[model samples]
Target chain A: MDLLEVKDLKTYFYTYEGTVKALEGVSFSVGNRKTMGLVGETGCGKSVTALSITRLIPDPPGKIIAGSVLFKKKDLLKVSDEEIRAIRGKDISMIFQEPKSALNPVYTIGDQIAENVLLHDEDLKNLSKKEKKREAWAKSIEALRVVGIAEPERIARSYPHELSGGMCQRSMIALAMVCNPSLLIADEPTTALDVTIQAQILELMKDLIKKFDSSVLLITHNLGVVAETCDDVAVMYAGKIIEKGNVREVFKEPLHPYTKGLMEAIPSVEKRKEALKSIPGSVPNLINPPSGCRFHPRCPYVKEICKEKEPELFDGRVACWLYGGAR
Target chain B: MKLRDYIARRLLLLIPTIIGVTLVTFLLTNLMPGNPVRLLLGERAASPETIAALEAQYGLDRPLYIRYFVYLRNLFMGDLGMAIHTPFPVSTEIMARLPATIELGVTALVLATIVGIAVGIISAVRSNRLSDHVSRVFALTGVSMPVFWLGLMLLLLFYYRLGWLPGMGRLSVSIGLEHITGLHTIDAILTGNLTAFVDAVKHLILPAFCLSWLEMAMIMRITRSSMLEVIRQDYIRTARSKGLRERVVIYRHALRNAMIPTITIVGLSVGALLGGAVLTETVFAWPGIGSFMVESISFKDIPVVLGITVVLAFANIFSNLIVDILYGVLDPRVRYG
Candidate 1:
């Protein structure tokens, strides 16, 4: 069974200029113990989707208009705030892109990690304050060790600024996995790191996932990362999932033109390219998105009909007219 | 960047600043019209012998530079010199009055900080809501109103109209409690005089509140903007994503980071409050260094004016130093060399 399923999720920002449909009808799922890579360009509502699942989007300006996010056979959207909060660190955890900024500067790494462990670990709740602190400290250091941080004890006691970017990212992972969460949502976790460090973090995440048995929803614009780590891929454009399938199937035969454009845009290391192919237009303005397909303006295979009506997702492939509704 | 070394270095840096402050104040006061000897003798006394003797006695007959050196030496010896009008030592008079000013200043600071931070946090958290709007309006009115006008209005309302508080002075005339700390409230408490303590507090409320209004507004505005900026930071979002309680996310994650700048403003406001107290003290006839300085400035009491200036300058520098140390405490990125 799917570990999580989001159906017809619609989130909008009531901004001053106009209503920004940040996430309009976004839908996908991550299978049990599977890594689903949500791929998109900047401002493609990938992060918004993740925030919506956790109900962390700031209200007033941001509102979840419609959706059902089902996790472990329970509708998360319908759950009470208390219920969702209980499930957050225990059942679902998240790691962000900017590692340095993601960690609180004032707190020691151990204090931050221990906080999560103490919050979700029911057995630790009943212990005396001193005992709980001691246990949390030990568990936090263990988590640091599991993420391959050398000198976990020292690193755990250090502040975020005292650590390097890679170390901070590793610590962030440690914080996410400290509670042994069932689902891990990593939003471009390596986007802000050096290429070498990015590769190391990706490897660490893959290894830790196997050890912890936690499903991951990795959100990134890096297709290479998806190819390396994710079992399934979902391509989002202008607040909607335009294409999704098994990573191999999608990468091998990108059904949608938008996905094809993204795939071609990835510069090849073996074959020296004159200039990488980039999609024609930028992401559509969500405040006033395109009437039909969001990618139609940038799609090479755009037809007159593509501008008239939006396509619906068919089968397990894409929501594009070229496939004539996937089989 | 050891904390002890940093503190020692900051202390050492104050010597030159204090020297410079004294030097400038001494020179300026000396350069002003009216001789100290003449001011002491009065215009009606035309006897040159008496004037010369007085000038010689006070060492004012020495050359300007020599007199400046003499003054500096005396200052270093902890002698603030005699007041031209009162014949009392300037330091003694200041010592008597310093506690009152400090009591007012400290009370105003504590009140401003507590109220400002609370209001600012509420405004930021409820941004664009009714409470935010109302607080913003209150902040605006506070900034725009002059301290003297506010002081009088408060006095008229609370003292004259309601008659719930004493109109002026540190304590009621009938309550002659022995002075312990010189600060009426503390002295009253020290002497176990509850009536005097309550009376002293009643007298303090109007002036302190009047003095705090502008600073409170400044602090509130700065804190609100700072908090607004911090709450938008990626870390705040990460804190929420961790499933930490909203209170923890706001206070622990956002407020601490926001406090660095707010602390700086609070430190700056201390200097501003000291300067502002002159007007506040005059309006309320509060027996503090502020009113003493005003009286000394008007009477051309150079020694008293210079003494007060030195004290104020030191107060400003020390507060700023404290703020810097606090910055180090709040943000680990700040390292003192």
Candidate 2:
């Protein structure tokens, strides 16, 4: 069975101007030990999609409009908020962007990891103060070890602000996976680290994921990261997924023009460029999106019908006019 | 060695700051049109011989800089000079009243922190809910109400209307407890006089509440705003995504980070509280250093006023030092020399 199956997920932000459809009817699925790479340009709703899975969307201005996020046997959208919370860190966990900001500065990285493990167990929560401390310490050390922190005992006692950005990110990944979560949602986890550190972290994550045998939802703007780490790819634009396929197939023969453009946009290592191949225009505004295919404005091949009626996710989940309802 | 060095550096700076504050209060107190001799010896204290004797005795006949030196020298020598209106030394009177003010300030501070932090966390987590709106309204209303007015209103409501509490003084003065600490509540508790202790607490309740109300509001608002901002941070999101409960997200991760701003506000409020105490003390008729400071100012009692100013400045400086030291504790990245 698939670890996660999201169907028509629609997250909206209710602003004064109008409701911004941040994630409009997005759908995907990942199997056990599979890594699904979600790629898009900035402001293309990739992060919003990740946030929607955890139901971490800030309210008042933001709301989940419609969708069904099914994990295992349960429909996550229909689950109680309390239940969703229980599932979030243990059933599925997330690694955030900007590792420096992703770990609470006031708390030690170990405490944060321990919090994830202790969250679901009432016994752990209800333990005597001393016992709670003992348990938290043990769990924290274990998590620190998992993240390749050699001095787990020392690091567990130290605050996140004392750690380097790379260490912090590793701690974050450890925190997410410590509960032995079945799935991990890593939202640009390596974006803030330098290129070398990024490669090392990704390698570590790959080794850990293989060792733990867990699924991953990898969201990034880096095509190279997707090519390196992910098994599958979903290219999104204007709050909608434009293309979905096996990572190698998609990278080798990108179906959507936007996907093709994204690949070309990646700066080749051979020569640093003065002007990289830029996607012609910015992401379309979600509040007042184009009538048809949302990416039509930026698409090199825009047809008349692409402007009026929105294209449906075709067979094999291709989202383009040229796909013509076919995979 | 580091902590010692830190404290030493702060103390070194504190010396000049205290002097500057003392000087300003001294100059202002001296400049104000008031006759200490007249206030001390009635209207007939203006004979030339009597005035000269008074001036010589009080060391007021000296030039401004000389008097200033005498002030500093006396302070260093453990003498805070004499009170013109009373037989007791300025230090003695302040010491007598210091316990009461400390009791009041500590109670009020505790009250402010508890109420402020709770309300702030609630308002931020449940932003835009009824509780959030109510907290916001309470914060604004609390800020606008003058301390004296609030004290009076509380006095009237709790004392006159309800007749549940004492109208003035630390207690009814009937129930006497051991005055080991000079603070009635502390002394009462120490002597195992629960009734007197309760009475003393009852007496403090209304005034402390009145005093703490603005501070509570400020704390709540700051905490709320800071928590709100921190909750939006990536760490909080990461916490939530960790499958941690909302309670953990709000309290453990968001609350502490939020305290960065709130601690700053707390330090400033401590200073402001000391400043605001004079008015509060007057309104409540509490015999604190604030009341003494006010009386000294009116009588143009330079020594007492200067003494109060130094104490207050020291209180502010020390409280801030504690807060700065706390920053290193709360956030490990803070490495102060």
Candidate 3:
């Protein structure tokens, strides 16, 4: 069974100019111990999907207007705030893109990691304060060690500023995984690192998730990273999931024209081409997106029906009129 | 550098700063048209001999450089010179009144800090809401209104019209307490004189609030904006996603990061506080160094004025030093060198 399944997730931001429909009918699922890559261009609601699942969108400006996030057979969107908060960090944890900025500057890395353990580990509740600290500290160091951080004890005592970007990201991973969460949502976790550091972080995350038996929802704009690390892939276009399938299958045979465009845009070392094919138009303004298919304006195979009626995910895999639809 | 070396370096800088302040005050006071010797002998100007003797005694007969050198020498020897009108050492006079001013200033700062931070957090958390609007207006009124006007208005209402409080002075007339720290409240508490403690607090309420109003507004505005900035940071998001309570996310994670700006404003406001305290003390008729300094300035009592200026300058420098230390504490990136 899937560990997390989000259906019809609609998140909007009420701003001064107008309502920004950031996420429109975003749906996907992460199965047990499976790493699903949510890939899209910038501002395509990849991060919003992660936040909506955890209910972490800043209110007033943004709200999940419609959604059902079923995790372990329970709808997370319908859960009480207290229930959602309890599930966050304990059952499901998240790591963000900017490793340095994502960690609080004032706190030691070890203190931050230990704090997560102390907050979520129920068995530590009955222990004495000293014992709890000792246990949490030990667990925090162990998490760091497991994430391939050398000298976990020393790194734990250091503040975020003292650490390199790679070290900080390792510590962030340690912080998120200290409680051994079942589901880990990593939102562009390696986007802020150097190219070499990026590979290391991706490799470390892959190895650690396997060791912990945790399912990952990896959100990134880097299709290369997705191809290397993800088991499944979901392609989003202007806040809607246009195509999804096993990574190999989607890479081998991209069904939607938008997915085909994205694949073509990448610089391939294996198949050298004269020039990379680019998409025709920019992403539509989400405030007042195209009425039908979000990608129809940029789709090479755009038809009258594609412009008039929004396409549904046919066969639970692709969304396009070119596929089997009301013809 | 080590913290001890940093503190030592800051203390060494204070010496040059104090000398510069004293030199400017000395030059300006001596260059003025009024004669210190003549001012001393008000009606006795009929006798030139008495004037010369007084001038000689006061060392005004010496050249400007020599007199300044003498003043500096005496200053190092803990002698701030004698006040012409009061016939008392300026140091003694200041020492007598310093505690009252310290008590008032410290009380006002503490009150302003606590209320300002609380109000700012509430306003930021409820941004664009009614409470935020109300606080913004309240903060504007506090900042724009003059200190003396606020003091008078508060006194007129609570003292004259409603008579709910003892509106002036350091203590009520009927309350007699031992003077240990010279701060009536502390002394009363130290002596276990509950009646005196209560009366002293009642007397302090109006002036302290009046003195704090402007600073409170400034601190509130800064804290609100700083908190607004901090709550948007990625770290705060991480804190929230850690399954910690909302209150913990705000107070522990956000507030600490937000305080650097607030501390900066607080440190910078010491000058405003000292200046405002003079107006507050005068309006309330509170017996503090402020009223004493006002009298000294009017009488052109150069020594007393110089003494107060030196004290105020030192206070400002000391507060800035404290702000630097606080910055290091709040953000680990700040390293002393």
Q: Pick the candidate with the highest DockQ.
A: 3
DockQ, per model, reads 0.74, 0.71, 0.82
lDDT of 1 at B128: 89
- Each candidate: RMSD: 1.9, 3.4, 2.0
Candidate 3 docking DockQ: 0.82
Clashing pairs in 3: none
Runs of candidate 2 with Cα error greater than 4 angstroms are: A119-154, A269-275, A325-327, B1-50, B63-66, B155-166, B173-178, B191-199
The DockQ-derived docking category for candidate 2 is medium
lDDT of 2: 0.83
Q: Tens digits of per-residue lDDT for model 3 on B1-337?
A: 4456665677787788778877887787788788877777676644888888888888888899988888889988889899877979989998999898899999999989999989999999999899999999999999999898899999999999999997778887777889899998999889999999999898899999999989999999999999999999999999989988889999999999999899999998887788788899899888888888898878878789888877777788789889878777777777544
TM-score of chain A of each: 0.98, 0.94, 0.97
Write candidate 3's Cα lDDT for A219-249 as tens digits.
Answer: 9999999999999999998999999999999
TM-score of each: 0.96, 0.90, 0.96
What is the Cα-based TM-score of model 1?
Answer: 0.96
What lDDT tens digits, residue by residue, belong to model 1 across residues A59-166? Answer: 978999998999999998899888988888778999999999999888889999998887889889679999999999999999999999889999998899899999
Candidate 2's residue-wise lDDT over A198-311, tens digit each? 998999899889988999999999998999999999988889888998998998898888888887888877767557788887877889998888888888888888888888
